[model samples]
Target: MVKVILFDLDGTLLPMDTDAFINTYLSKLAPSVAEIVDPDRFVKALLTGTEAMIRSKDREKTNEQVFEEAFLPLIELKKEAIWPALDHFYDNVFPTFSYLSKPSPLSRKIVEEAGNQGYRLAVATNPLFPRTAIHHRLQWADVADIPFDLVTVYEESTYTKPHAEYYMEICSRLDVRPEDCIMVGNDIQEDMVASEIGMKTFLVEGYVIDRGEPHYRIDDRGTLEALFRKLQRKEGIFAEK
Candidate 1:
């Protein structure tokens, strides 16, 4: 049975320019801590913190911990200062970045329909951000009722997508096999990699990058809506095969 459907955020669910979000986020974050650490060093520390979390091997620790562990030593700031900056970043800067996102009414409708149909939906967004940040962004898309039974955040996941273990972890947690789930996302390399592990895949072409013109691309949410409805009507996703 196809018990779960995992969706990526940012480009996939939220529909935003990733670079714009980062540039806006850093601009807000930099000035707040400029006095505490060298301006250039602060930026370097922040990037390092992000990278460390990406490269983390300790699955038990949350991403925030990994970021702090990597970042704290470089800045020489009190441990307490980090949270405040994070708060400022999300509070003041994050909302503005939503402007970069192009809203899709059909996207919300599809996700809601999937939840109503009893699919185990999850916002399988990369776990680099804290849950709070992710939660707020989802709200911006007007996607309520966190449809996912399990949400994968960078902190909670030891491996990021493109790594088969990343997809396997969610499948294991949801008690489903790789072939029983579909991963939908805008990035070809990051999201389509799920196919390498035997899961079904969909590419949302509104944001697709040619990058060699990968196969299995769908042009818009209307196509995705059609697919979601078909899956909903199926008795068992793999039964036809």
Candidate 2:
């Protein structure tokens, strides 16, 4: 039984160029934190922190902790100062990032259709952003109204996807086996890697990126919708007895 359907936010549901999304994100993040420290240096330290987290042995640490360790000494400021920047990001700067990600009409239709079919939903987006940021992005995609059983946020997630443990945690929390889940996303490396854990994988081809490696093919979104329609009629995607 395909009990859970997990979808990535960026590039899958919300359409955007990956680079443009980050540039708009940083442009807005910089001005907001200018009052607290050197903006350029601050962003640099933040990047360093991000890299550190990628290599971190202690996956239990939140991105905030990873960030603060690299950023704190440079600013010589209290932890309280970082809050303003984050607050600004969640309330103001983050909204502006929405301009970079446009809503797709098919996004809502598929999500709504899937929900009606009784599949548990999850936004299995990479948990690099806080919950607020992730939530707002969902709203931007107009799929915010669609209830998700679990929205993985960096603060709460111990592991990022592409790591088998990440999918394991989601299955454990949702009480579903990896075999009962389908991870849908645009990135071949990040999203399709879920297959390694035995979850079904769907690559949304709307925004394809060829990274000079073996391509994990995704049946197009239209094909997916049709497949769901067939499922609704009890004609499952795979042959059934």
RMSD list, candidates in order: 3.4, 2.7
lDDT for 169 (candidate 1): 77
- In the range 1-241, model 2's lDDT, one tens digit per residue, is 7888898888888877887888877877877788777789878876776666555546667655766676677667777867776776788767866667768787887787678878899999887777888889899889887888999987787677566777888999999999888887888877777888787776666675457555453433433455455545645332233
Count: clashes, candidate 2: 0
**Candidate 1, TM-score vs. the true structure?**
0.84
lDDT of each: 0.72, 0.74
Report lDDT (Cα) of residue 72, candidate 1: 90
Over 1-241, each residue of candidate 1 has an lDDT whose tens digit, in order, gives 5667788887767777787777877877788767666768898998999898767666677677888889899888778876786677677766666777877776687687778767779877877887767877888777856556887765576666556677887887788888788787877777777787788777765665446644443322324455456555642332334
- Model 2's alpha-carbon lDDT is 0.74
**Cα RMSD of predicted structure 2:** 2.7
